[model samples]
Structure formats: C-alpha cells, structure tokens
Target: MRISVVIPAHNEEAYLPRALGAVAAQTLKPLEVIVVDNASTDRTREVAEAHGARVVLCARKGVAFARQAGLLAARGEWVAMTDADSLPTERWLERLTARAGGAVALYGPLRFYGVSPFEATLSEQGYRAFLNLMALLGRPNLAGANMMLLKEAALWVGGFPEVEAREDVLLGWRLRRLGPVRYVPEALVLTSARRLQGGWGPFLLRQVRNLLGDPRGYFGEGGERER
Candidate 1:
C-alpha cells in the first residue's frame, strides 16, 4: 500500500529538519511526506518545503486540528503519523508495513533522545508495561510519534478529535473497534526530551495525569509555544 507520512508541526523550526531527514532515510520511503504547519510563527513552512515535504497550513491552534487537516489531504492508502520532534528509525516504515498483516493500525515503542540513559530505560520500560496492560483490557496504547494506520480507518473514526491531549489514544481506541491494532516493539522512534525540561519527576507525574484524566501534558501549554 502507498504510504503518506504526516507530521503535525508547530514552531518546530529547531527540530523539523531531523524529523524530515529521518523520513527521507526510511527504508520503505513514503509516497508523500506532509508537514502540517499548525499556525507556526517560525520558519516551519520554509523548512518543510526545503526538505521536500508538502506543507499543509492549519490556522487552527491545536495538534488535533493539524492532524485532521493532514489526514484530509493525504492521498495514500496508509498514513504514517509522527511528530516534528521525533526521529523514526531508518527501517521504521518498512517494519510497520511489513507487520501490518491485515491489521487496521500499528503502534510501536518510543525512546526519548537527549535524555539520560537511566531516564530513557525507565520511560521505555514503563511505557511497555502500560502497553501490555492496555492490551489485556482490549484497549490500545498508541503514541503519535510512532503509529501507522489505514487512511480509510482513520477517516471512519471521524479523524482526530480537536482535543488538547490523548487524541492519539482516542483515535486508537476508535480504530480498535473496527479491527486489530498491531503492536510493533522494534519499530521504535526517538523523540525529543524537551518535554522533560522541568525534570523527570514532574514530567512523569504530568504524564500520569494526562493518561488518567484530561491531557494537560502537551497541548495545554498552548500548542505553538511548546512544540
């Protein structure tokens, strides 16, 4: 199936290049690379264009809206979603597509870059445990940074809700109702540790809060400023 990789970016001038470069390096290259510029005041559009990514403008201020815009514009049979601050492994796309095997969606592990080794290990292990638990409950543990889904499946779920956080997880839950959501442990993506600026303790606490209740982790800070 043809794949379109969509990246929802907001003021990601500092990190867009790395994200785009990783897409370009994918073993199974995408049919198209789309970068949804979410009202970025920075050079996000220009940078995306420079990397040969089609720039889709979303004046709306949230990642959810930006993602919906990209999904609407995407023409590929499958959609690969990643954040502007994340770096997919060279074989990320190839592995995901290979393992799709009739599944409607796929999600994998994430390893944070620019973080201490101890922190990375802890976070990775914790996330894996969470994924396992969710699987037991017939729910999906999907991260926007490393997920692939059928474009038709995403549209069927009404795209992503215009919420501040947990939109990825919400989308996954809806998709699961239609068909299987595959887990790919080796198709890892390296994401920015910028979110941990306040230190690991608070960052982790905020993550739990995001998972348990409303997501005040990422979008609550006003989309553009944080990304």
Candidate 2:
C-alpha cells in the first residue's frame, strides 16, 4: 500500500531537518512526503525543499487547516500524520501500515523528548495516569502527533475539522463510528515537550477540559462537538 507522510509545519526550520531526515530514513519509505507550510515567516519551506520534501503552501495558520491541505493533495492510499517537531522510528511506518489493514484509523503512543528532569518525570507519570483515566472512562481519543488513516476513510468522514486544535480527537471520534480504530503500541513517535513545559498548567488544564468534552476551548466558536 502506498503511504503518504504529511507534516504540518509553521516556522519549524530548526526542527524540520531532523523530522524530514527521520522520514527519509524510515525502513518503510512513504510513497511521498508532503510538508504543508502554514504561512511560516521563517525558512521552513526552503528547509523542506532542501530535503526533497514536496512542499505545499498553506495560507491558513492553524495545524488543522494545514493538515487538511496536505491530505487533500496526498497521492497515497494511506496518509500518516506527524508534527514537524516529532521524530518517528525507522520502523514506524512499517508498523503502522501492518496494523492498519482492517481498521480505518490507527494511532500510536507519543513519548516526550527534550524535556527537563522535572518536566520529564511529570510528563511520563502524568501521561500514563491520563491514559489510565481514559481507559477507565472508555474514551480512546488518540493524539494526532502519531496517527495514520486510510485516505478513503478520511474522505468519507469529510476530512478533518477546521478547528485550531483538538481536530485529531474530533476526527478520531468520527472514524470510530465508521469502524474499528486501533491503537498500535509498537509504533512510537517521539515529540518535543516544549509546549508541555512552556505552559504546563494551562496546557494540562485545557487537555482535561477537552477530555471532558469541552472542545470549544481548543477549537474556538463554530467548532463541532466530540461524538
């Protein structure tokens, strides 16, 4: 199956190289790598082009919009999404493709990188605790930092929401209704912990609220509610 790796970037010149390199080095190379530049004022586009990634200019600013733009342009049957600051293992795509055959969507765990000692400890502990809470509540909205979906399934669901945040969760909820949404534990992606550390309290508070179904705080007005 052809797989397209879509990365939504905004002023990520510093991290784009590493992320792209990881993609290039994947054991299961994607059919194409599409980097959607979200009106970046930096050299994000140049860096992506330098690494031979097909760069798409997204006039919009939000991650959701950029992701949609990339997905719409992707030429692969399967689309895998990752952040510009995240790094996937060499076998990440291989594992994802293997587990995605019977499911409309597949998501993996995200490990934090470049975190301070205290923040790392808190992140590790808190992330697991939150997962436990989600399981207990029978909620399985996975993070978008490491996810893959069949293009047909995404199209059938009318693509991702046009919100600023929490679009991944919203999309996951919609996909779950169509068929099984599997969580592949073997495919792990490492994401930077900058946002979590820079605004720990508020970031977590908003996450808790989203988990409780208050998605408006993350998506602003006119956003769809979680199913």
Candidate 3:
C-alpha cells in the first residue's frame, strides 16, 4: 500500500533534519512526505523542502490543523503521522505495513532519543510500557509520532480533531469505530525528549491527566503555541 508520511513542525529547525533523515533511510519508503509548517518562525519550511518533503503552510498554527492540512494534501491510500522531532526506525514503515493486514489504524511505541540515558529509560521506556499496558486495558493509547491509518478512514472520521491535546487518541477512538486499530510492537519511532524538559513529575502528571481523558487539565487553551 502506498503511504504518505505527514510531519507537523513548529520551529523545529533543530530536530527536523534527523526526522527527515530517518524517513529517507526507511526500508519501505513512503510515496510522499508532507511537512506542515505551523507558523514556524524558524526555517522549518526550508528544512522540509531541502529534505524533499512537500511543505504545507498552516497559518492557523496547531498540530491538529497541520495534521489535517497534510491529510488533505496526501495522495496515498495510507497516511502516516509523525512529528518533526521524531525519528522513525529503519524498519518502521515495513513493520507497520506487514502488521497492518486489514486493520484500519496501526500505532507503535516511541522511544526518546538525544537524551540522558537515565532520563530516556525512565521517561521514554517507561511511557512505552505504559502505552502497552493501556492498550491491554482497551484504552486508546495511540500516538501521532508513530501511527498510520487508512486515508479513507481518516477522512470518514473528519480527520484529526482541532483540539491540541489528545487529538491522536481521539482519532484512534473514532477510527476504531470503523474497523480494528492494532498496535505493532516492532514498529518504532524515536522522538525528542524536549517535552520532558520541565521534570518527570510534571510530565507524568500530565500523562495521567490525559489518560483520564482530560487533555485540557495540563495544556491549557491547546494550540500549536502550547507545546
């Protein structure tokens, strides 16, 4: 199946290169890569174009809006979502396609890169474990950093929600209503640990709030400006 990879970037000049590099090195190449520049003051657009990614400008500035823009621009049957700061494993796409079968949506784990080993283990690894456990509990634990969904399914679900927080999980839940949403353990992506800059306590607390279906609790007035 042809895949279109979408990356939403906002002032991501520092991390976009590594992300695009990973996509270039994918064992299973995507048909297209769309980088949504969400009102970035930095050179996010230039970086994306340099990496041969189609750059789409989202003047409104929000991950949700950027994601929807890329989804609309995509030509592939399957749309893959990843942040500009995320580095997909070489076999990421290959594994997802292999495990997809007739599934409508597929998500995998995200491990943090370019961070202290201790922090990575505690934050990234721990979070991944939590995601797996949440899945076992029948919770929607999908992440935009490493997930794919049928284009038709996404369109039917009205694309991603306009909200900033937990839009990924919301989309997953909506997609599940149409068909099965599977988790492929082997399909992995390495994302930036910048979000955890505050502290473990705060980050985990925010995660717990989201787990309880309260994205608004931590990220107030959700938008591209927040994170």
Highest lDDT: give the candidate number: 1
The Cα RMSD in angstroms, rounded to one decimal, for candidate 2 relative to the true structure is 2.3
Which runs of model 3 end up more than 4 angstroms from their true locations? Answer: 215-227
Error of 2 at 82 (Å): 0.5
The residue-by-residue lDDT of candidate 1 on 5-49, one tens digit each, is 999999999999999999999999899999999999999999999
lDDT of 2 at 49: 96
Q: Once model 2 is optimally superposed onto the true structure by TM-score, how far is the C-alpha of residue 98 displaced, in angstroms?
A: 2.0
What TM-score does candidate 1 get on C-alpha atoms?
0.89
In TM-score terms, which candidate is top? 3
What are the per-residue Cα lDDT tens digits for candidate 3 across 1-227? 99999999999998899999999999999999999999999999898999899998899977878888888989999999999889999999999999888899999988887787887676656877788777776666778898998999989877777675677887786788788899888898888888778966887886786567654523444322222
Look at candidate 2 and tell me the lDDT of residue 75: 98
Ranking by lDDT: 1, 3, 2
Worst 10 residues of 2 by lDDT: 217-226
lDDT of 2 by residue, 1-227 (tens): 89999999999999999999989989998999999999999999999999999999999788888988998999999999999999998899999888876898888777788976776667756775675566456555667778898888888886788777778877877787788787777887888987675577898886787579664633555465544
TM-score of each: 0.89, 0.89, 0.91
Q: Please identify which of the two predictions, 2 or 3, would achieve the higher TM-score against the true structure.
A: 3
